[model samples]
Target chain A: MYRQKYLFLLPGLLVLVAIILFPLLFTIRVSFSSWDVYNPGLNWIGGENYGRLWEDARYWQALGRLTLLSVTTVLIQYVLGFALALMVWRDLAARRLFRVLFLIPMMTTPVVMSVLWRTIFHESLGPLNPILESLGIGAAPWLSSAGWAFAAVVMVEVWQWTPFMFLLLLAGLLSLPNEPYLAAKIDGAGPVRTFFSVTFPMLGAISVGAILIRLIEASKIMETVYVLTSGGPGTSTETSSYYIYIRGMRDFQIGYSAALSLTYLIIMIVALTVIAKLLVRALVKDAA
Target chain B: MLKITDLELLVGSVAHLAAINASFQPGTLTTILGRTGAGKTTLMRAIAGLIAPDRGQILLDGTGWTRLPPWKRPVAMVTQQFINYPHLNVRDNVAFPLVRAGVAKADAAARAEAALARVGLAAMVDRRPSALSGGQQQRVAIARALVKKAPVLLLDEPFVNLDYNLREAFRKDLVDLLAVETGTVVLYASTDPREALQMGDQIVLLADGRIVQSGSPRDVFANPASLTAASVVNDPPINPIPFHQNGVADFGALGQQAITLPSGAYTLGLRASDIRAGGPHQARVTLTEVTGSETLTHLSLNGLDLVMQEKSVVLRSPGDVVGVHLDLHKGLVFGADGQRAGV
Candidate 1:
């Protein structure tokens, strides 16, 4: 007899299948077919789209670019976030106001934040270049030039996402016991030594967690690139997600985009798994 | 010698430590005896430089440590909670202080190892603090404190969290371990009076953020400065009775006694041991408790609650009337102001 108790799980199971499993299964099936604007039906063309994307230099180049952009941005975010979190963790005047102000960027919608950043990056008419010029630093082309444009994208990512890291690290800091700090103080450790010996090491597992979450979110960089650089002055700011968006939506290559997406998903899973192992080994002592 | 003069600390109008004047000579372990929330921790924290005193000075061998940060002060403290570094192993946890104080890692490790062995935790040196038992973790904390060998060692009820057997055993081990450090001026805080009397070279009685008495353990015990101090230092708690005097002091159902004194009002503090079974007066047993080999029986005599202690275990149920003898000579007497008075 079928257990009547399992009927209760059906609603939740159905929702999971509809929201998650179905799309993933459908995308996998669609990847093997050659579907496009003209060839709208799911006509089988086994592995042809995958074969083409493997040789496509643009896809690989975009993957490499995405890797550089996310890693650099996430690392910068981690450092800046940790510094900010520590600054407001204790004994600061107007601490609550500062905490709220620090989280404002993360609280904003990503597309809106990107648009605001894009306006700031406007070379001739923006507030940023004028301020930089006023500070005796020569103004470079922000959105027009490749290097500055990439920098601008990285800047936006860091400014918008650093709060997530800060929040996690600060929570970790708050939960820490007062005894270790007391012990450190009695041990005659200065502030810097205490940070390295006690605070930083104590926040290790949380650091890894914040970094991983940021990295995963950062790897799928789309809205900021779409608004600011549009992958360009010659594809310099084009990330993997943006490239996939173009292939799927702009050019209408459904089968090819599906293949690209599945590849990206698999690569992210494998890469993140390896990265997690390496990070846990380095940060957490028990894993070592 | 470590001296504290007129040290006062107020936490927003509540006096945490008020006018606390005390001193400790080298090698003497003075137990700051008090009940919980009696400013024992506040006083110790002030000495450790964790909290600043609002008034007066803390001088350790002519060095003013009132404004100095805890890290800059030459001190080591073990708290009531068994706190050890969660990230570090037992060995590293012990060696951390020495290493941070500019000692070489290898030298610190060797010393830490020796200290661990002294605390009977030699086998668990490589294990993390989380992996150890509560007693073991506390021993690690003690080992860490000892490894520092700082001149001023403040132990704030270090074995409070342990079980009875572990606490008893750890106290003996601590005494043995601490005996070797002859130059170290150790200050131990304990709420238990018996522990204070047993462990302290001297006892400083604290009540309501004030030092009620300070003397040798026997001196403090023999002459309690205040009724509050007397009651605090008594085990099974002292029975405090207020007497209305009119050439005779009221003793409730134990009967009034004519005393050679002229008094308006006075309080008599009596221990459970002062009341013996078999006498002219009778008290009804309200409750009976057997702790170890002794029996503590609660009684109601003429609408007054009293306690009688027996050396042997005797189970007397509720409503059972028993004849009790009042040992007046052993009972402590106090004035209306709670100050101890001569019988």
Candidate 2:
């Protein structure tokens, strides 16, 4: 009877295989083929695409650019999210109203928000440059220069997803026990000391969890780039996902794109694992 | 010395604590005895500067402490729950206050080690609080509170969460540790009357956010000012029987006592220990609880509920009929307004 009980899990297992397992297996097989727009058929060409990806300068550049963009944006979001969470977590004049207002950005769709941000970042006609000019800070370029386009992409990503970090951190702050804070207060710890000694240490596990979740979401950073910059200003903001999209959809190199996808999945898995370990070590003191 | 005058705290529209006036002497542990919501914690928090009273003056050593924040006050407190820094080791947990107060690092470590040794936790200084048992974690909290050596120390039911055996052991350890601090005016809050009677040098009985009685334990036990005071000072709680007969205190069906008193509505306070089994009056057992080696049985004679205490375990189920006898000569008499009249 116990042996037959495994059949009870068959439905969920079938759904997993249908949606996830089959695509993965098919992609692994297709990665070794020589399928393209011109050829239009799968022909065995083992390791050729992998060898080309290894020597592809543009692919390497996109990977590096993806790393820099994600790490910078995630760190900025973490800091700003923590600050906003602390602000609304405690006593405020209009706490409920502010909390709902803070959630507005995250509630909107990211691709839609990115499109709105594109209009906002328009060089002369947009409100941002005009305000900067009024404030005595002249606007040189937004989407017209390489560095400015990169910064514009980061700005949009930060604006769209920072509320996610804020929500998680706020939930974490709400769940923390109030007793440790009382102990800190009685021990004569000022605001800074209490934060370092009690609040930050208590928030360690949740902080790491939130950061890793954001990193995973951030590493796949192509939607905003697609809507806003579209790998603009000569490939300055072209991340790994957009490079793959260009190869598979735009250039129609299905075989090579499949190879890139599998390689990118493996790289993300290793990189995220490494980052999680480092975060756990750095944030949680007693875990060591 | 610490003194509070006319302290009033309002939560919503309810008065959590009102018209409070109390004084604590140095080298004495004043146990604030009350029920769970009797404002014992609010009073302690006001003294520690964790809570603000709407109208009050807290004078410490002839200087006002009302305006100072908790971080500025020279006070240390251990709450009912076990609160220790999970990220720090046991020694660092104890040393946190000292380090925060700007003591030398080595001096703070030494004092923390000494406090840990005093609490019988010398062998576990390097372990995190999460690695210890609940009792050990509370001990770390206690050691941390002790290492500060503040002039005023407030412990709000510090051992209320521990198991029975651990609570007893930690209580003894805490008393021993506190005995060494001669200058600290300790305010210990508890709902257990036995603990309040045993550990307090002076007892403050609170009811409905007011101090019903405050005196030495022996004095309060010998002469409870009111029915509320009598209830707070009793372990199993005192039973108040209505009596309104001339020259006799009628206890309705259970028995009556011929006493020299005027005819008026009064309450007769009877201790649980004075009521015994196997007597002329029969009562149905309503509840039975076996705690340690003693038994506390609740019996209802007619409509009056009376608790009987026995030295040894007596297993009696609910609805079981049993005979009980009350010692009327040892009872106390309270007036119609609940104030103790006389014996």
Candidate 3:
């Protein structure tokens, strides 16, 4: 029976090797060698590309910005998403309608959403400036200024992805055993007390899982920054992925880009691994 | 006293409860007996202030409780599903109510320990609910309710999820614990008649959203007001046969004794134990079920079927004719409307 199961898995294993392992091995090979389209030659350069990457200021800046973006966006998304999920989950009226409405932003393609937001944040022609002017606020550069550009990119990203967090957290909230809430109520616990004591603790594993997933996705954020800012205004909104794109596609430095990409991949793996460990610890603690 | 007067609740165009009136005294365990979908839980939830009744009111010691929310009421509930905070240990789970009530940590811990010890769960105070057995989890739930010191405790089939042996053991422990809880009005709901008889000081029988009868368990058992109430409290089911008068009370082959009853169409309710075997009246044995300690012999006579409880050592089989005698004095007589008629 075990051998039959293994035989059944052979086709899936072959597909995984072809689609995942092959490219991963190729990327590692390319990261070690000085290979570019212009040279059309593969010359092994040991760790020179990686050594240069350590001294690269722009690369370090992009990494810092990516970290900042991931942390800030994930935090904001979690708070807003959790609040929205609580609202719809608690409301008995029009709950389904509100849930569907809240999921619309996530349903739209991210690149298309970014393009749509680009027009909305247009400095002079956008509707947002006119609305702000109507509200007695002066017109400010939304996508032109360095700080405002970064804020605008973060806003778009948060707006588009917060719904994913909402969906996940809402499902977690719904699947929670209802008896505890009733017990809390009969125990004379107020709403806030029940939330902290009963709701929050019960949602531990789900919250960690949601944060981990959102962290991984938000770390690789590129399309919104690319479409809206294109790393413009002195690289203020450039992320690691955008920087890698610039090095490989624009500068034709494939070897250096591959090394940067590999290092970024390693950082993501480590971060995700830590998050997984935390999740396991939480679940084990719950069991214990 | 907790007085429920003319309580009516509508659940999505269906009447869940209608004109339920009962007064529960302090220091008493009132068991609500009903079948599934019989609105037993609805009545308990109304008393807990978890759900609002559409009409009527619940008053505790002359104060109206219909408008109060569950959190404001001095009530605690243990549901059938043993609901424990999976992330918290037994101590914290039991102490949560005290902490929420703004008690000091040291005081809450002490009280939680006392309550856990009351439920025999003090040894497992540091273990999470997931680590404990189902019975232990329910004990934690009970301890959580007990620590709240709520005057009104609602237990909705608290031991329905446990195994038979565990249920029996926990039932005894619960009875002993509640016996000392003076001034607490506990309302327990169960579909099991034997459980109600075992745990209830007072029994309220419900059927189809209305109270069929309410009295002491022995009184309700000895003299059920209606056929529904009789069935609600009878195990192995009461054998009901249509009774007709022809110048004398005739109960088919289960021969009836002399009794003065009014001339009208009625039904007779006989408990299995009241039907005596080995008499002049004859009934063909159709089936014999042998339990460890007792045997339930199913018999049929003149198109009426009846069951008789005998010792397990008795030898009986299908298609055998046997003499049966029904002790009519121990049976109940119901009118055409299924209400117990006066003799």
Give interface RMSD, per candidate.
1.1, 1.1, 1.5
Number of colliding residue pairs in each model: 0, 0, 0
Candidate that scores best on DockQ: 1
lDDT for every model? 0.90, 0.90, 0.88
Q: Ranking under lDDT, best-scoring first?
A: 2, 1, 3
The ten-residue window of minimal lDDT in model 2 chain B covers B245-254
lDDT of 2 by residue, B64-92 (tens): 99989899999989989899877789998
Off by over 4 Å in 3: A1-48, A90-98, A275-288, B12-14, B241-256, B286-292, B311-320, B335-339
lDDT of 1 by residue, A121-167 (tens): 78888889899999999788998888888999999999999999999
Candidate 1 lDDT over B134-222, as tens digits, reads 99999999999999989999999999999878898999889989998888889999999989999999999998899989999988887
Report the lDDT of model 2 for residue B308: 94
List the lowest-lDDT window of 10 residues for candidate 1 chain A: A279-288
DockQ of each: 0.66, 0.63, 0.63
lDDT of 2 by residue, A206-284 (tens): 9999999999999998889998999987898899999999999999999999999999999999999999999999897
Q: Please tell me how candidate 2 rates in CAPRI terms.
A: medium
List runs of model 1 lying over 4 Å from the truth: A2-55, B237-269, B302-305, B332-337, B340-343
Off by over 4 Å in 2: A1-56, A93-97, A253-266, B86-92, B103-113, B123-131, B241-268, B275-327, B340-343
